[model samples]
Target: MNDTVKRKLNIALRINWFCYVGLLLLFVVRNLLLEGGSIQLWVIQTVPLLLVLPGLIKQRYRSYLWLCFILLLYITTSVVGVMMPTRGWEDGVMVALSLILFFSAMMSSRWHRMQ
Candidate 1:
């Protein structure tokens, strides 16, 4: 990639990383605080994300692909949450953050590979 495009890709990757973290935080808050779930339960629920975090921090395209699949699950969960009566807004936040992460990762992968 050219200098400018590589820079842009880096920016996108950073956004993707931050959004991923944000979504994870949302999950923790929703499950542990809002729903009164136990820490062990929350850790079990979010463990898969931890597997991908290192690769994502290293800006690996493979991790982005894996994250896309994970984000789909999150999207579905958010949609179901939105359908619920009380938790709709929280789910909406998840939906938006997941989408942002999804697009950022997707674009970063594409552009980075074009190098």
Candidate 2:
């Protein structure tokens, strides 16, 4: 890839990382505040994301692809949360972050292979 494509890939990767971390934090905080700090809930929500961490840190295209799939689960749950009568802003934020993460990861992986 040329410099511009490389630059774009880096930006997408950075956005992917940022959104990934944001979703992680959101899950942690949401569990703590709404689930009485339930360890089980935290583990269930975060373990999949954590599983991809090693590959993600290595900037592996396969990891990014897997992340896109993993994020779909989050988006589904967040959409349900949004539809609930007692939903809060966090649900909306979660949906936004997950979507951003999914797209960025997808694009990052595509760009990675272009090199």
Candidate 3:
């Protein structure tokens, strides 16, 4: 509602848009240079995630809840994989990324709300 919140929200939205565009560009490169349907799927999955960015920027409670759910799922998957015999390093990376997103959403929302 305040100027600080507006500024933070704008920044969050800008960052989110940059990421979304980057992802799509990667997918395009993969499709053009390489050749993979999987890359296409990744790009498609990216859209919904990008779509949620606006809500997060607005400091919507539901967006925060969604972020919490995502973090929980990331944690659960990483833990399960670590406990498993055939664990992969990327699973840990997933956990890290999830934490980053979660913290970013919370901090950004808080920063936006403070103003």
Candidate 4:
């Protein structure tokens, strides 16, 4: 890839990681702090991302593509949460952040494959 694309991909990759990790942490912390949630519940919230983290850390295009698929699940969940009567601003924030992660992951993977 050209320098510009490479830089863009790197930036996107970083943003994807930030959003994914931040959301994961937020889920865990929010549940534990607010609800005294169980570790099992936290694991359930986090295990999906654990499956993809290694590949993502390695900057694999295939991983990025798969992550886009994974992000769809989160996006759907966030939208549903936002629509629910009990949902908060946090749910809306998650929806926005996940969309950013999805876009960044898609673009990063596409750019990586193009190179």
lDDT tens digits, residues 1-115, model 1?
Answer: 5898889897997798688778778778877887566888678758877888888877778888888888888788788878888775677898899888888888887886788
Minimum summed lDDT over a 10-residue window in model 4 is located at 28-37
**How many residue pairs in model 2 have overlapping backbones?**
0
Sort by TM-score, top down from the best: 2, 4, 1, 3
- Error in Å for residue 99 of model 4: 1.0
* lDDT comparison, 1 vs 3, better candidate: 1
Best to worst by lDDT, what's the order?
2, 4, 1, 3
Which residue pairs does candidate 2 place in steric collision? Answer: none
TM-score pick, better of 1 and 2:
2
TM-score of 3: 0.50
- Backbone-clash count (model 1): 0
Off by over 4 Å in 2: 33-37
lDDT of 4 by residue, 1-115 (tens): 5999889887887898789888887787767776656888778878887888899888789998898898899899999999999997678888988899899989988998988
lDDT of each structure?
A: 0.81, 0.90, 0.58, 0.85
Expressed as tens digits, the lDDT of each residue in 1-115 for candidate 2 is: 6999899998998898789899889888888767555878889999999999999999899999999889889999999999999988899999999999999899999999998
Q: How well does each candidate superpose onto the true structure, as a TM-score? A: 0.85, 0.94, 0.50, 0.90
